[model samples]
Target: MPSKSPAQAALEKADKKANSSSGWFSSSSSKYEEAGDLYQQAANLFKMEKLFREAGDAHAREAECREKCQESNEAAQAWWNAAKAYKRGHPDLAIQALSQTITHLTKAGRFRQAADREKEIGQIYLQELNDLRKACESYERAGEWYAQEDAQATANACFKDAADLHADLEEYPQAIARYEQVADGSLSSALTKYSVKEYWLRACLCALAMGDPITAKRNLSKYSSLDTTFSSTREAKFINIITDAIEAGDMETLTAAVYEYDQVMKLDNWKTNILLKIKKGIQEEPTII
Candidate 1:
């Protein structure tokens, strides 16, 4: 074979080098496009599958492309749906969705818009469902959100409702503590009166049921002082006999009185007080007529 001229060889070498470079560039660009297409396909499939979590992951990969294509609305909608799906059986997810919604709306300067969603979640946990603890937690979250928005009364009311439910469960210490909070805070008179009265009555009933006469008497005195009509004619009559027997210092009479009262009252307190009084009297006097 005849050797080529220097210029011809050099031109040929340059052409070959250009072609190789072009080929490499084309291959790299094709691979990048393929990756982009795969990501889009995965996102579409995730949407169809209602797999929000996977969709979110896939969307994160193409976030720049999504922003350029005005696909943020679609991403937002997907996140919202996924949050809802988790909410039915997952309280934590519901809370996350609510938080995200608040964040997004607040960034957009539409705080009130986010508030509606938050209130919906609060009502679901508080009223429609009977999960009082969860409901109260939700209310507290709402109250914080409302307070941030300067809605004081709404926040206070939420706290009040939470406290009332705690009281209903007979958590006396917690109930009393919450009641004190309301009394000290800017709570309304109507609510204050209702809660105080209800808590007092419940405490009294609980002390009575627990067979604590001292506590019962204290509660009774408070109740009677508050409402003069708070009278149990039957109980008073039954107790009168034991009081008389104690004052008379007669064991036989006390025993007979308690037995008679038991026949009429048939309650532990009446029997207990009668026996206690009779034992005390008998101990004080060794001789009985």
Candidate 2:
């Protein structure tokens, strides 16, 4: 028979400790604390054995024990450790661990840490799992939390990621709404006000993609009225040119306008891809006799 490895021995000890009740003289909290310590020991031993998934499970058990003891901070830390251990081999499990971390952090009034973990969950869903919808949901949650914390820049960034994913998924209405929300939020801030034009431009692009030139044109006018200076900006002019070209079914003009704007400010992949979609829409419009 094969000898038990150190990790296996530690795990057995942890299981035995966790299953046993507190002595008659000791409190239940003491039992849970003892079990948590044993679980932590098992986790460390499993890490030494390079059994990451097992280590993650041990950490999760520790977190449960901590929760039973009403130790929110300790539970949050254990959940975070579980997430890190599960991240490389089990992305879905990592996300679950992160969700628990966020929960405990929130319970402990650690909103910023919870928001940060929410963003991490979004990245894992986006990059590791290719689950765009879940990623968007996670980002939106993070953005809301950051906004509540007055971290506007970080909030807007998360909102943009969610909006971009919405656009990629062809959920134009959602994309437009999020962009407009971010743009409106920025209008009152001197530092962020100048960036609102870009957000409005993206919203217009989403409207155009939905084959709603009227809405797109109206949005440009609305932004001008709201910002007062929007009408004179390069973004406003570009949107006008693109809207007119779409109305006239002039694909060349649309392409040239995007190229001109890109010369001033190089468009990123999200903008380039949306513009390509807009151009395709123009090409598909049937010419009236």
Among these predictions, the greatest TM-score belongs to 2
- Put down candidate 2 lDDT per residue, 115-232, tens digits, no spaces: 9999999999999999999999999999999999989889999998899999999999999999998998888989998889989999999999888999999989998899889999
Worst 10 residues of 1 by lDDT: 13-22
| RMSD in angstroms between candidate 1 and the native structure over all alpha carbons | 17.8
Q: Whole-model lDDT for model 1 versus the true structure?
A: 0.50
Per-residue CA lDDT of candidate 1, range 1-289, in tens?
9996443343344334323433544654343333334444565566566665554444343332333344444334434544555554555565565555555556666544565566656666665456767666666666566667777666656666655555455454554455444433442454444344433433443343333445545555655565444444444433344444544555577578657756875645523642454365445665555
lDDT of 1 at 261: 59
For each of the candidates, give the backbone clash count: 0, 0
> What TM-score quantifies how close candidate 2 is to the native fold?
0.90
- Candidate 1, clashing residue pairs? none
With a 3 Å backbone cut-off (N, CA, C), the pairs that clash in candidate 2 are: none
